[model samples]
Target: MVQRLLLAGMLSGLIVALFAFSYARVYAEPNIERAIALEEGGDHHHEEAEQGTVSRDTQRNAGLLTGLVAYCAALGGLLAIGLAFLHGRLSVRPRSAVWTLTVAGYVSLVLVPQLKYPANPPGVGSAETIGTRTEMYFIMLLASAISMAVSLWISHRMARRAGAAPSIAAGLAVFTALASLLMTMMPAISETPYDFPRALLFEFRFHAALLQLVVWGGLGVLFGQAAEYMEQSGLRVEGTARRGIPNA
Candidate 1:
């Protein structure tokens, strides 16, 4: 069962990758190009010294496709494992559960952390702080994910006594408070050049967030349908086997 779910997820991911890749190629790549141009224009010496081995065209095409494929595939596998654990636990249909999980995942893993440390296009930040920025981002992501899980557990526990609506509200409140505290406690890092185009920066971040939404939303829809079909097929098989049994 786990294996089947994993396969379904990976397949769905592969299908969704096409849409993600297209979106990135169309909306995201131009911003990256402009950012690279600005960086190269500002620092010819650095650009010459650090000439990349891969061409920009390759990076925008093959590299982008490869990255999207791998990322979505891994995300799908994780989603599959999550669905297996959550199976029959959420009281909702498989599709609803998958969509809920997808939304939660985007909020916890991407939206919350991005609010703190948004995605930056190439040549935006200093090289010296790259490691620090990465570490901080991952820390924020981890905390957000943990908080979400705990809040869900809290909601589940309280639902029995407080009723569904109140339990959900309480869970949201806890998550909001925890996320706010973490964001405040973390040291802020602003490395964007003062002279950088604000419009370009905003566009890049917006497209980055949109790209993630496309991937997660697409996965939820596709995988949910697949899961429902799988469930119905299994039931039919079981019923057929029962009918074929001996009357004794």
Candidate 2:
């Protein structure tokens, strides 16, 4: 099971990497170039200039590919581990597992934190505050993960006491209340200049969200298929071996 899941994860990661590389190369790279141009010397000028250690070519080509693959591979491995733990809890069938995991992935990883901290293009934020911003984003992510886990536990307990429908409703209500409170309490960071192109910002965020959907959705579907195949094949082998044994 572990070996099969590991292979599935690698394959799923490759799929995500390919999709990411293509989407980023097409939609994201141009916006990034434009941002670089603005930073270098454009109308949207700021007092602080962003430093660049690497050339745009490397960033667009090798750097982007490397980062995407590494991130997706690691994410896929973690997801495989999650699926392993969730085995038999969600369902024995791969299709059911896929459906459940896809929703979980989107809600826990993408939807929650994005509501608090939306994605921005290059020119939107200040270089000096990058460290602080990164720290805050990770903190938000961690909080969101904890909130999701707690909500799931609550739902499971409630389901046993009440029923599926009521449990779902109560879980959603509690999660929403908690998430809203967190969002309200968390410090907001808005560094985008008023003059910045709203359309570009929207487009960047849209593409970013789409990228997450593609990667995670692909992982769920592909990994589920792989796991199902392995399970079925193993069962078939076992059946064949049993049939070959002499009747004693």
Candidate 3:
């Protein structure tokens, strides 16, 4: 069970971490494209366009990356708390605190914005566009700072059990994100021009699907935890449990 605790804690934290990184790519790609279309110095690759200049894309993507990373970090803390419960390793107060911050952070970043503006993009230019964009940046920075601290605590808690590298988890996450992006592309469906290489057939549905479902989602604790728990229980009954188990 101790080992399980360590493994679960690490896996959960990683799931959240990957989600955070995936959010960045999601925000960057389309947001950058929109910037290229809308703003003066949006496309850096274009020589006529100024490079390294901050445009709406930078603001939007920056805040988005910040906000999502923060949320995921907090979620990692929350997952750590859940791991603690499973392991009998954390106190109620500390666990509750971590869980609270996780939910609070997520709502503040992902949900609260909905109160002022809807979560999904609403075709950019409305009266709300300027102010909404401004508000998004403010929230992103605030959330990112708070979440980073919480994530650090989570990482410290899971240092031993989270044996896998963060980079590995990130790979799974980004893979899923790429799948999601392909599945949702509008340009391909509409015969509109998209510089990105994508299609409606086998490429995404099979190749991308495999990585997303097998690699990324497969590594998540939430999905695998219950099954693993049952398996461990069965093993303990069979006298195959870890050395800590008392002989029955």
* Cα lDDT of model 1 by residue, 1-248, tens digit: 89999999999999999999999999999999888888778546535745767777788899999999999988888888999999988787778878878988999999999999999998788898899999999999999999999999999999999999999999999999999999999899998889999999999999999999999999999999998888888888888788996433
How does model 3 fare in lDDT?
0.43
The runs of at least 3 residues in candidate 1 whose Cα sits more than 4 Å from the true structure, single-residue gaps closed, are 42-52, 245-248
Give the poorly placed runs of model 2, Cα more than 4 Å off. Answer: 42-52, 244-248
Compute each candidate's TM-score over C-alphas. Answer: 0.93, 0.87, 0.34
On TM-score, the candidate that comes out on top is 1
lDDT tens per residue, model 2, 29-87: 87776765665576344223423456567778999999999988887787677777777
Worst 10 residues of 1 by lDDT: 42-51
- TM-score for candidate 3: 0.34
Off by over 4 Å in 3: 1-7, 16-28, 41-73, 82-109, 119-248
Q: What lDDT does model 1 reach?
A: 0.91
- Candidates sorted by lDDT, best first: 1, 2, 3
Per-residue C-alpha lDDT of model 3 across residues 152-238, encoded as one tens digit per residue: 455445545674366335433443343344334312212222432333222322332332232223234352454356446766776
Q: Each candidate: RMSD to true structure?
A: 2.7, 3.7, 15.2
